[model samples]
Target: MGKATGFMEYQRLQEASEAPQSRKKHYKEFVMHLDDAQAKTQAARCMDCGIPFCNNGCPVNNIIPDWNDLVYNGKLREALDTLHSTNNFPEFTGRICPAPCEAACTLGIIKDAVGIKSIEHYIIDKGWENGWVTPQPAAVSTGKKVAVVGSGPAGLAAAQQLARAGHAVTVFEKNDRAGGLLRYGIPDFKLDKNLIDQRVKQMEGEGVVFRTGVLVGKDFPAGITNWAKETVSPETLQKEFDAVIIAGGAETPRDLPVPGRELKGVHFAMEFLPQQNKVNAGDKVKDQISAAGKHVVVIGGGDTGSDCVGTSNRHGAKAVTQFELLPQPPEQENKPLVWPYWPTKLRTSSSHEEGCERDWSVATKRLEGSKGKVEKLIACRVEWKDGRMQEVPDSEFEVKADLVLLAMGFVSPVQPVLDAFGVDRDARGNARATTDGAGCYKTNADKVFAAGDMRRGQSLVVWAIREGRQCAREVDAFLMGESVLPR
Candidate 1:
């Protein structure tokens, strides 16, 4: 789809980054996007493979080849349009998505994959600079109304599509900001908050109404009150709107029930992340968690844990240690055995590079503390045997810890929220909703639907955007007897 001989002429080039020592001083984005020359060269790396597995590999199915060709030809505007055709917010995905498309690139079969994410970042940023990313309001109103619960990527995507389809769309968010995780959960160094604000402004011009600080259901867990100021029952939305979409994220964090769990200085990752984010946004955060001068121990080895590591370093923690339950994967994957599929391999994030002492196949036995405050963590090394974790004898140890952050990930959506809507849940506690069939995205309740993490469990932002777009199509069809929106 790009130059025929370009793949042989170019090598994959990553975006430049500021030194860790310098970037750790603040939370602003330190990674710079590719320039015009670099972006064009990177896009030229795309080859005309018989089949572009990269397309299917991407959850949103972005037209990678088409955009790559456009960028190589210096058609930056066209490239931006192609990128926006499938994904609503390339700015978010370009910065934070793991880029499964790059992993499945044809060039990756023999060499490094094309720099699709960086090119996307370049195109979107250029589009914004040129004032090309404007609102596309529907000309005719369908007179139907849609109430979307949540302001995360999924809810935002669905609301934008429905608004463009001539329906009045209202997004209800618990937080006082439009972007949910993008605004609160993620660190500012990885993604700037201004990008989200830009999208929210464009969506508003497109006729999407966003009501922040309005909870969609009741009995929200503790600490939720910090974000939500008012409540709107599911019945109110169902009564007022023609159709309702529940796209709330998975909020129930998995807990560590070890001894001294109730001690001070022990907290879930969400509690720690959102507070820093709020503080960055100029909001006064009372009793904000700080890793400064403290021995920080982050549990779990996924992105959440990595985020903890980065945030801790930014806070100038005395020391940062991360733990994982599973054995570490090989540094390099056997790509031939898992071509075009996401391979299990070691991934070192910028956060890890900042500074962290990481260990694998370890389990926390308990939290040791003094006088209602956490002081140390008791842990043991383990080995996997026949898919079961077996503790290694005489391997139990303890480490000093002034702060303990649990980044073990979430289990499901807040149950009471789903209960208020009378939506049936799956075995995993996710809202019961099918992505395909005659009645896709339809929940057990009439005129109600579910999508994204609330229905699919914890997943990437790309997957959430995909579900949100697909669910919008289903909702449009249900309301208008047919849908013009893309799946």
Candidate 2:
């Protein structure tokens, strides 16, 4: 610990955010990082907890205390090194991670949790500014080739690690750009696309090849979000590469199959989100779905739904409303009951702060429309008892909705890719693979491995990076009979 009494002496200070009214006018990052002195003070607040639950709390198991001490002592480069030891991409996580590590912070038991996320954001941003981030090309050639499917966080991490382990790695992306969800699915306001480009350039310098707009599968179905300009058969990869890793993420979004789901103006969050991201990147899109001057209704009160709300507000919508079928969680979690773990509580994002009418315990009965265009939503209040939901009598209501966006999360990875590889699938439709023992990350098919959302179903980016790093180690060992890559 840098300062034994630092936690007692300092109160938690969050990063400042742009005014919602002003920020909603443009699709750019509004959160401002803490200056050096403030970051040092925040880092000093890390308590001398023996267990360091935050390490376990973080999906990538970042060495929080060591970096906190280093930052507090003004050893900026040392802090960055300690950070890079566990996590491959702090810049991505620092901006988007929910910071479960802070929830598990020991100081959170009695006072506010240490601002670990802010400190990380500061450290990585400083590292980039100081030209500390650079290519770490392999020292020797292993004379092996690896193929990574998908260009999301998991695929990127796996490719980088495998390349650095002296193997030729090529990443194939179905999209026209490198980043998967980060490039399209996410709004540009939270994360700038240039950050992804910067990392991709560095990875290329480290001997990793990125093939964008290249789909590595066959029998591509229409209506599925495939941006591939060219298709490469799975057989080609199996023959050309020594090992193939499936990191193509969970792309099959869960659908709302109620009546009138076929109505026009109702779309998946993916379809709506990617268009805006593309537009932000200065790409022209035809017949783009616009929320401008429409009564927008977003279903599913999750991160995706929140993103819809933000985008809708930016488009100058007439009104925006969000719906959740589940009951609202408590405003504050019981710390004694759920300490050192992620707590369940009400979470209001910056999008909600901008403007949104949020409701819970409501389920949509059907979407009513005129001339094949959605006009309104029929909903009803419901009660959950004995694990069963029953609609409340006489609680049906209707809300005006010109455009409806379904953001109810994803169900599984796109099955065609997995099928093309002949990989077994779990009951949940993720690629079936183990994460322990001798066959960790290895799929049922020979010379093929799975990791990240493709194997674990949709999850956090940090978890995807962890799985990617671990999967790379397993793949390396499988190739060379042993590996020095960390688990």
List lDDT for all candidates, in order.
0.92, 0.93
- For residue 329, model 2's alpha carbon misses the true position, in angstroms, by 0.6
Model 2: ten consecutive residues of lowest lDDT: 218-227
TM-scores for all candidates: the values are 0.99, 0.99
Give lDDT tens digits, candidate 1, residues 392-442.
999999999999999998999888889999999999999999976899999
Model 2: which residue pairs collide?
Answer: none
* Inter-residue clash pairs, candidate 1: none
Which digits, one per residue and each the tens of the lDDT, describe model 2 over residues 303-374? 999999999999999999999999999999999999988999999999999999999999999999999999
Once model 2 is optimally superposed onto the true structure by TM-score, how far is the C-alpha of residue 368 displaced, in angstroms? 0.6
In model 2, the runs with Cα more than 4 Å from the true position are 219-224
lDDT of 1 at 483: 97
The candidate maximizing lDDT is 2
C-alpha RMSD between model 1 and the true structure: 0.9
